[model samples]
Target: MFITIEGIEGCGKSTLMEKLANSLRSAGRTVIMAREPGGTSLGDRLRAIFLDSTLRIEPWAEAMLVNTSRAQLLKEVIRPALERREDIVCDRFTDSTIAYQGYGRGLALGPLEQLCDLATAGLRPDLTLFLDISVAFSRARVVGRANRQDRMDSQSDAYHERVREGYRSIAQGNPQRVKTLDGSLGASELLQAALVEISVATQ
Candidate 1:
């Protein structure tokens, strides 16, 4: 199972990813949990640079760097595990580029999708859970965090709103593969909602 979780920052993807992994492990499934702009040593370096709030990056540059990290991750971690028949749960993937760079930064979608296809070699999630939240709650959750905001996190409300809208559009376009969850709901509810789709996907 190649499952990817995506959403705007502060949308509780990390929390729910943890729960999903644990549940799968409890059921004796070998789950490989991975995150991106990360998941390998090279990816970590890119992640640090990509997430640095103090730095400014051009839209194309941002797309290139993150996809570079993702490419490294696919080679180093994601593919091998899948070949071994291990279930993989990934945090963010190609759709993020479309949402963030293409939608949020107003980059050209056609090229961005091409970059994504090149980076992932056409491998896509078997199931995608998009935790949906409004920009206002997204802002509140992000602001309340104790850690300093990342470059993407520090983007303006309008940018985040556009990203959220992009996610909605992506979900609508790919309904068979992606399911949108209401992030304002409690964690357990979100987990149950996700598991419903997981059950169908796995069956």
Candidate 2:
């Protein structure tokens, strides 16, 4: 099973992924945990470039770079894990591209989806967990936890708001595959909800 956890920055995706992976491991399931933009060596280089606030890039250029990194990651990491029949948990995936580039950057989503489809050759997660949170709450979490912000994190509040909307749209459009979770809950509560969803989906 390929499961992706997605949301805006500081939405607790990473934390929840870790908890979920541990839970699955304790259940005797083979699990592979990974993250986008840096799952492979080449992808890591692209991740550095994409996340660095120092470099100014056009929206299209940024989109292209993210897709390129994804192409490499899918081939080198994601596909291989799935082939082994390992349960895969990913921090982010194509949804992030749609949210960050298509919505946040005001770019056309059709072309972006097309590019990603070609990159992954039609591969997609079996279940996508959308950790829903407001842009203000997400930003506050980031500010309180970290001293430094990435290029994407440093984006304007308006951009993050658009990204949050994008995530909502995706979840609404794919209700059967995307499960939207209210992330304002306590960590244990969130994990329990996610595990219940995963169990139902897999069954």
- Best prediction by TM-score: 1
C-alpha RMSD in Å of predicted model 1 compared with the true structure: 0.7
lDDT of 2 by residue, 41-142 (tens): 988899999989899989989888878888998888888888999999999999998988999998999998998898789898999999999988987899
After superposition, the stretches of candidate 1 with alpha carbons farther than 4 Å from their true spots are none
Model 2 pairs whose backbones collide: none
The sequence of per-residue lDDT tens digits that candidate 1 reaches over residues 46-148 is 9999999889999999999999999999999999999999999999999899999999999999999999999999999999999999989988999999998
TM-score of each: 0.98, 0.97
Those runs of model 2 whose alpha carbons end farther than 4 Å from true positions after fitting are none
Report how far residue 95 has shifted in candidate 1, in Å.
0.7
Whose lDDT is greatest here?
A: 1
| TM-score attained by model 2 | 0.97
lDDT, candidate 1, at 45? 96
In candidate 1, the residue pairs with backbone N, CA or C atoms under 3 Å apart (3 or more residues apart, or in different chains) clash, namely none
The C-alpha local distance difference test score for the whole of candidate 1 amounts to: 0.93
